[model samples]
Target: DIEMSTSTRGGLLKGLGRKLAGESLFMTTYVCKSATGMITFTPEAPGRILAFDLEAGQSLICQKDAFMAAQEGVSLEMHFRKRLGAGLFGGEGFILQKITGPGLVFMEIAGDVREYDLAEGEVMRVDPGHIALYEPTVDYDIAAVKGLKNVLFAGEGLFLATLKGPGKVWLQSMPLNNLAAAIRRYIPSKG
Candidate 1:
């Protein structure tokens, strides 16, 4: 039952009044400035992405695309990459699409979000899609490590995209893929 104060941007501010919890299965909302279009994450709310709009009146349940917004004078793009050895080798093992944001962005997940400050001359390895937002000044590149024996026997896959930063990074505790997997486990198995 976390609450966020409304913005002072001066418009008809109102809560659409929809109960979007466990019963509803997948919907959440946050306050955003219609003028600035900037929204922040909340703790009580899930850390996964949810649908939102600046112009729409009624609350809507939309797909992944609905959460994207263009702000901070930068364009948003979705980048997808595939992982070869996922669960079997403690990997995500699927194509993950991440939203590249260069502004004040908001994303909702299933648990509390965490922020890490990458020190100067230091770098960190993160799951490709877990990167919520980062400083535009950081450098990024996809690197592939070669080791045939490791891939075949040790199960250590050889490729990963490395992001080096001297900036802030946000990661969501709950990934969308994990959420989907949870739902699948509860559904009646067809086969």
Candidate 2:
């Protein structure tokens, strides 16, 4: 159990850096009153994500995956994409973002973020980065419609990332460009 308190001073609070097994604790840096904090997990790592709603003290499970991370007081669940004809039209994908409560989210990213708004009944097609974190209730699926072949091919790609109705989506301004840049800088070029 870790105890953290809010600091009146601004700028992100420093990380506590305490590790534990299956423990849920509050993150002071990203937490806020109106919105919840977010966190991301990487592959081949082991740690249990936990959250608690102050209103009820109800604990929530963040997610179970090597590529998963969590905030102190946020909850998460598995959301499945609906299948279409022969289950081939739509692919199987899962979004482990947020479930309930408003706080803060901690994300490990390569660059800054960019965000967009989707009005009620409005759908937004994004390239993963456009979505930092979102509510678990929203529906998602691969936007591989047959008619818009040109749009898919020319614009982005075959897989059009779609998010539906009434939730906040955070997007990173720069995409995976940073990863490639890092590799180029560190790894020696072989002539």
Candidate 3:
């Protein structure tokens, strides 16, 4: 039903990079030779599918493993935090997914979703793992949890993602990792 155009140059490098990012080594492109055909990708979890259009010269950053599929011309790569502290203590570790395109991309966010449009200088702090995706225009950083009681007892981790935006941000109510941890607690462990 479809044809794929393979990259002849640097194919091995791209495949290796994707593998290090916890993705499949090969990215397949589907083309419909027939008059009518459709290509579909389904989310692994039962959650919302979010679509974003990336214009030329624009890019977006997403949580690792969030990328589902994209149009043929889009490019996906790894993005790193510049600060050493962020690399050491940030929620997503040192690297996130960076997508650049003049096309559309679909990503999956677990559970219900909330979207906020932030004006310049507006700031919101969120649990790092809950962040779905954000525009490049937004400034992202990590903040230490405040107060001894809250930091130690809240169970929300030592750092929260601080997003200062003049752009949009998407957050998910339930991250799949969180759900998996919760479920794991109930299952009887075999010694």
Candidate 4:
């Protein structure tokens, strides 16, 4: 086990926030004891690892299970997005993981990853499950699927999470939740 610097409420709150996000009860903090040190972390699912720098005053809002590890100075919080449409139909409940940083963070996404840099006023509508992370500057909302025919026959679900940005957003090509549902279709039923 690695020894970590500990502060009473600060340490406990960070772990608690992660737990509320469906993660393990504890966070492993690795302190570099020398000039340089290494720690290896891998998410349980098969996925791509992504890293980013979070400057002061910026926060990264991510999928519930996306966070992997971070430098010591980073902070963890929870976000309950206020978009009612997203809350009801976006698949990822309104509650999400919020990471605040003046530090570096590493995240894991369910499969191959793609990123987009959105200029001011640009927007993207995405399947909520495919959303991995985005800057707080991005405006996240939800939109209804346009036509009844498309909603009922497209198999694309009824609503999508919309991101309007002057910020960056990342998407995962294969969302584990979708993959699991597909795999369930082929599994033999309990006999």
Off by over 4 Å in 1: 1-45, 48-105, 145-158
Q: State which candidate has the highest TM-score.
A: 3
Better of 2 and 4 by TM-score: 4
lDDT of each residue in 23-115, candidate 4, tens digit only: 656766556667766678887688899887888867988988888888878877778888777777867787788988889988999988999
What TM-score fits each model?
0.44, 0.45, 0.90, 0.88
Superposed on all Cα atoms, model 4 deviates from the true structure by an RMSD in Å of: 2.4
TM-score of 3: 0.90
Residue 101's lDDT in candidate 4: 82
In the range 94-137, model 3's lDDT, one tens digit per residue, is 87888889899898888889999999999999888888888889
Q: What tens digits encode model 1's per-residue C-alpha lDDT throughout 1-191?
A: 33344332222221111111111222333545454564444434345453323232211221132243333322223222233343122233222223333344444545445677777767776554454444434444445545777557653345544656676555556556666776788999777
Distance from true location, Cα of 57 in model 4, Å = 2.6
Candidate 4, residue 178: the lDDT equals 84
Report the Cα RMSD per candidate.
11.6, 11.3, 2.0, 2.4
The residue-level lDDT of candidate 1 at 189 comes to 70
Error of 3 at 174 (Å): 1.3
Q: Candidate 4's C-alpha lDDT?
A: 0.82
lDDT of 1: 0.41
lDDT, candidates in the order shown: 0.41, 0.40, 0.82, 0.82
